[model samples]
Target: MESMNESNLTALAAFNHNEALTKIPTFLFLVLLTPFGIIGNAGVIYVYGCRLKKTNLQHFITLLAVFDIVCCLVAFPLKMVELWLPVMYPSGNLCKVQNSIICFTCVASALTLLIISVDRYKKVCRPTQSQMTLCHAKILFSVITVISLIYSVTAAFIYDRRSIPLDSDGYLVGYTCVMDFNSVVTQGYFLALFVVLVIVLGTMLVLYCLVWKEAKKHFMQSDLRYRHSENQEDGEDHTSPHKRNLHRTNRTVVLISLLFAISFVPSLLVSVLFAQFTHVQFSMTTRTIRELIYGTWALNSSMNPLVYGFCNENFRTEFQNLRIPFGCYGRYPAPKKNDIKSIAQV
Candidate 1:
């Protein structure tokens, strides 16, 4: 029994050594993802921060995008370093800091999405209820801020570097700021947090479904009323504007739903898998799969800009105009005197 245990430990060490050496491909892949993520997420922040006036929904999404960008910036570059220079890298303290930031930002993003869903639910399902006021938005923001700070500090302290015996080799292996999953406190905390995240995400999904159903029902009824009104006017153009606006709103909602799913689902799945399968050893085969999962999660940072540009008419117009050169802008027709006068009258 002693011999078998020694052999197993020897094999695991060899596996880790081999895995550490072959990280070039992973590094190069991250090099590709990082720039796109930075550019796209920055664009999202600019759009929400500069163009849109401050509102509860916009505030939540703007901050969420900011957190996503911060997480990618803090975590992905270190991940590349860990991949490329696994041996020479001194991640003793950096790992703890980066991991904590990642965790906090990820939790903040999830909470923001939950808030957005609840807001939509109230707006659609219970429209009679008062809209979320500025005070309410501020309180929610403060709560998220406090929770994220507490989580980051706690995780950073708990996940310090440790030295453990390796096999019977009489030598110690030093782990640098990686979570000690075997520790009782670590396991318990993770289990509880995982359950909370699952419940929050599940609630968001259910609420979104309810919002969609309610929106559909209300839209159909509104369409019917508009059609009846038009019919009373001998099928004239009374309903055209209403129908156009409804179509635009529906399109926006569908796009937002798709973006949310694309951005979040991969990370959520990876988290659940990690929680459930604690004993799954990291191997060459699993390395690529793990990188892919992280890469997919990183893509969310890029997807936000695309979603905004495609779904929001105002954003699309702004993006197009911003892309044009000054010379090109000069070539466009200026407003006529009568048009300026009419605008002033309005």
Candidate 2:
């Protein structure tokens, strides 16, 4: 009997060690990502919100940065605490708030991406159609905030503190934030979130496909015209700025979408599996996979500024001149009315 008890304790200790090892990735992400996310997103917000002229594109990009900031400041810290002290995370209210903020950021970011795709499609594919204006962007932002808030509140209600058994005898235990797996409503909520994500991603994919097709056709015609132009000087094609900018914008959108897909798909898939197959005992491998996927969220939030800096010339210029130490402000030149109009046509 003593040997049996010793063996059980040994097994529990090994399991605890493994669990701690599995959390290392998440901890590293949170530690490395928090500062970068906060600073990078803050820079984006500063450039778009304070430096540039107010445009639909600026608004949407700023909003995305805002969501990323919330994830970094609120969600990431709570997650780190939860992982570090799985047994003693203050209270259920904190967990609820953390989950709520996570939900809000995810929902808001996805919807904003969808809206940006629609806006890009309209501008690139249908030049004669009405483009999204600043007013329209404001309306859409408010709508998304309200919609996201509603869903997030629902998430807050869905999660609570749950006890985790650390031994076969249930003598050693830990508390963690979790939802009711046995509840049909909880499972259904997760299923609904998954369905919504799929639909949003699908719609964005279609819009981008059409936009790319149109942009390619437009670029080919422009290239042909430039090649045959009588005023071509020194074998230089000067009419390619619009095409370059257009391609850069397209690349930025693609990168953001790809990041979102890579970050969210695995996490959501694991969530769906756990929700739908509650009866199935998840092995250590599965749990480790889930933790790794969850860690990707921080990477996703931290990467958008890099994407913007690398893909957009305007953003790159601003970022280059963003000297923090000297307190000298870098000014982004406001586009002239004609330049704005020409950009809109592109």
Best by TM-score, which number? 2
Those runs of model 1 whose alpha carbons end farther than 4 Å from true positions after fitting are 1-26, 161-177, 225-283, 323-346
TM-score of each: 0.74, 0.85
lDDT of 2 by residue, 1-346 (tens): 8987787667655665666666777788789889988989988887777666677877888899999998999889889877766554568988999888888888888899999999899989999988988889999999999989988988988888777777568866666788877787777778778887899899999999999999988888786676667467665765566787788788888889888888788887877666667566778677666787867766678888888877766666666666553222445445456544443321
- Residue pairs whose backbone atoms clash in candidate 1: none
Q: How far is candidate 1 from the true structure (C-alpha RMSD, Å)?
A: 7.4
Q: How accurate is candidate 2 locally (lDDT)?
A: 0.79
What local lDDT does model 1 show for residue 41?
A: 71
Candidate 1, residues 229-289: lDDT per residue as tens digits?
Answer: 6675554554444445444544544465455556556755675467567655677667667
> After superposition on all CA atoms, what RMSD does each candidate show versus the true structure?
7.4, 4.5
Off by over 4 Å in 2: 1-18, 230-239, 276-286, 323-346
